[model samples]
Target: MTLLGDLLADLDAEAAELRSVVAGLDADTWATPTPAPGWSIATQVAHLAWTDERAALAAAARTPAGREAWDAEVARALTDPASYVDDGAHELARLDPTELLAHWDAARAALGEALCAHPSSERMPWYGPPMTPASMATARLMETWAHGLDVHDALGARPAPTDRIRHVAHLGVRTRDHAFTVRGETPPAEPFRVQLEGPSGAMWTWGPADAAQRVSGPAYDFCLLSTQRAHRDDTALVATGPDAQRWLEIAQAFAGPPGPGREPAGCADARSPHG
Candidate 1:
């Protein structure tokens, strides 16, 4: 399977997993706060669904002019930052549990179809920059994993870690420079090595081990902390170099204003099925 295809499969699986988790949730559960400070579990699902629709729209636009139009639509959606999550939450809340799953399944299928139709190398306009269809698909996977972690935290359910999360992890590592620049920090000149603890508790390294700067740690922790799925303090990632550590300090894979990005206290003993 192509890289994009593999990513789409992961996306489909994660979305379905989320739907399954939320399927039988009572209204009260939907309103329960996720690990994210202000957002509820309902808000997380809504954000995922809304972003999928937007990504599909973006992928469908073939021509440069068409891509431009799609970008304009995304810009419009951001004017009321919370509207995307709010609309999704309202829609999900109105549906019976079964209907909600049906909607989620259909939405994911449509998204997969949109991704399958485009070649990964086909460039498309993104909210911040131009990216290939493949890159956009990875973005979707990253969001799914990030938000999925939030749901898992809220339910006190520990999800099994998967190396499949590597794609998102790589995205986070690659975006280190951008993350730093977004925070008004000087971009590093030297390449940084990244090591992450995988699902099986094995180390997965990215970049180079002996590079001037290095990021090394358990994969799950790095993934969680990078995506803001969990607090950095919740994990045991060690960045030997100051630049590498600083990058983790404000690392974010998603595009938007800077967030709290700090490691919350008591993350080690926080609720988790795996623990």
Candidate 2:
């Protein structure tokens, strides 16, 4: 199966797992602060719900003209992050736990169904660039995993890691040029090779070392660092090449403003070796 196919399959499973957790939460627990600053468990779930709904809209409207329309619609649909956050909090707070879980479940299923209908090669317009359907699905999975991690950490719960996050790590490595541009630097010529360790204790590598710099390290580390879900110092990645190292320093898997993220506050729960 294609990378996107693999990611979506994993997403389906993860989404279900998230629902199960949320379903079991008490109202007090729903208001508990997630690892993400200022966001409660309910808000975290709402953010995912928003993303899933947005992705489904993007996926279903893949035509050139349709994409333009979709962009305009979303632009109109969302006000600003502050306002969006407020709306999300309100929506989640108002729903019963069962209804909230159902809403999240349905939104994810919609995204998954749309992803299943398209191949990786099917082109669609993302915020600034065109992406294959597979690329889009990978993006969706990455977002889910990142936010879900917030929920997991807040509850002091540990969810099993999966190979799906490699897609996120790859995106972070591949977006070095974009990151440079965002930083007001000239885009570098060399592409960077990415090597990360997956959750299964397997090594996953991508890119060409000859044509690009090399980004080699544990997959979970790179994924966490890139998503701003974990701090860079908390991970064991060593970017050997100059450009590769630079990419790691400012890597971002998601497209948006730079984040105010840091490594985990404490090293007490540093990653333990997987059996």
Candidate 1, which segments miss by more than 4 Å at Cα?
Answer: 63-72, 78-97, 201-203, 267-275
TM-score of each candidate? 0.85, 0.84
> Which RMSD does model 1 reach against the true structure?
3.9
Tens-place lDDT digits, model 1, residues 121-212: 77766566877877888888888888787887789887788887888888888788778887888889988888777777766777766797
lDDT of all predictions, in order shown? 0.73, 0.72
- What overall lDDT, based on C-alpha atoms, would model 1 receive against the true structure? 0.73
Segments of candidate 2 deviating more than 4 angstroms = 2-4, 62-72, 78-93, 126-128, 210-212, 267-275
